[model samples]
Target: MASSRLYLSAKSAAALDAELMSSGGFSLDQLMELAGLSCAQAVYKSHPPESKRNVLIIAGPGNNGGDGLVAARHLKLFGYDPVVYYPKRPNKDIYNRLFTQLSNLKVSFTDDVNKAITETDQILDAIFGFSFQPPIRDPFVQVIRLLESTEKPVISVDIPSSWNVDSGPPKSGELGAAFMPDVLVSLTAPKPAAKFFKGRHFLGGRFVSKEIAKKWGFSLPDYPGVDQIVELPADNEKL
Candidate 1:
């Protein structure tokens, strides 16, 4: 695996996505599919189906949520009983298609956020990505509060919800409950906020093109053998 010192800001990562598309090596659909698949793999590796098969995925209203929805489908195939709590569905047709896919896979959706946690052995925090801002609204806030209250571990996808793109979090330091997670699965590379993640950190999304990687000076470690995920060095060890 590559050394853990490399970090990419939100904007840069997005640019890499665009560049890859331009190169004709990847499309948004293909990228999302692989990204979500990688998340499922990480979840499986961290907590196998036999250990904690009940996964409660809290999907947001954007691409991050789509990733979660996709991950849910894969997790079910991987033998884990997966459920989703998607309170806000995007108006975009793409999300609608994803919703349909998950439904077709027989992955159930729950309306009661708090009750959902009680029914899960682990939580997948896919409510936000690198672009999410603070002052989270309504039912989501309540849901976050409930996750904090529970003792079960949460596996956050990409950047943790409500955190800034470049910085770890706000200086006011009020987002106590939702700021941390048990495991963080970063797609492509780690963002700045990932530096504060005090848990198992794994890097996914090894599908980046060499052309884009060179342009951005992004050095990626080869995926060890055929594995899709690689564990990152801890925060302190990053130096």
Candidate 2:
């Protein structure tokens, strides 16, 4: 299906985020909570707790990782066992508070990526988002490689790790089909990279207000009653 919704470029995505915090009066934590909750809801809709109970969340050091942290907590509340693997933890107050929340919930944290991957039923790839740049570094190189080779279903948040937000996936040889997630949860709006995604796509981050949508020149799909996310058709022709 050809979508009437707007797909944001990386630059536009950043601007929208700034606008949200400045004029929109949304705090980082508030937005992250909503984004993460929507992500969890999307995951539940696609891969329910009954089947995919153990979720291994791969989180990075940025706001994307913050989203993963929030999602892990919500997933735990939803009855899914969430184990977070956040290698490079950011030393920010917001991130620290999020970690403390998860810690308070007694959520498991693991350093062994391979072991976590083996034990989990599904993976939530929150390692990167729209702000990511190319040239995968240490630690994450191994993590992304494993994600690329894993058999378990992977669900990416916003944009897939290692992919250029505006340019889609890397040129061949860098990463292959295994890196492609089985499901993608686009927050606020679908980023340009989403145009190349071929999977079950969900539009989340329903907190976007009408004024913001109109200001950004993007229309949001009407979310079903009380839903945090709305599924978009697989067709990427108009993503």
Best by lDDT: 2
Clashing pairs in 2: none
Candidate 1 residue 16 Cα shift, in angstroms, is: 1.8
Q: Each prediction's TM-score against the native?
A: 0.91, 0.95
lDDT of 1 by residue, 1-239 (tens): 23333677888877777777777477777878887898898899899999999999999998899889889989999999999999998788778888888888899999988888988999998998887877889777887667666788888888877667678765564654445788999888788788777999888867866765656765666688877778876852442
Give me candidate 2's TM-score against the actual structure. 0.95
lDDT of 1: 0.81
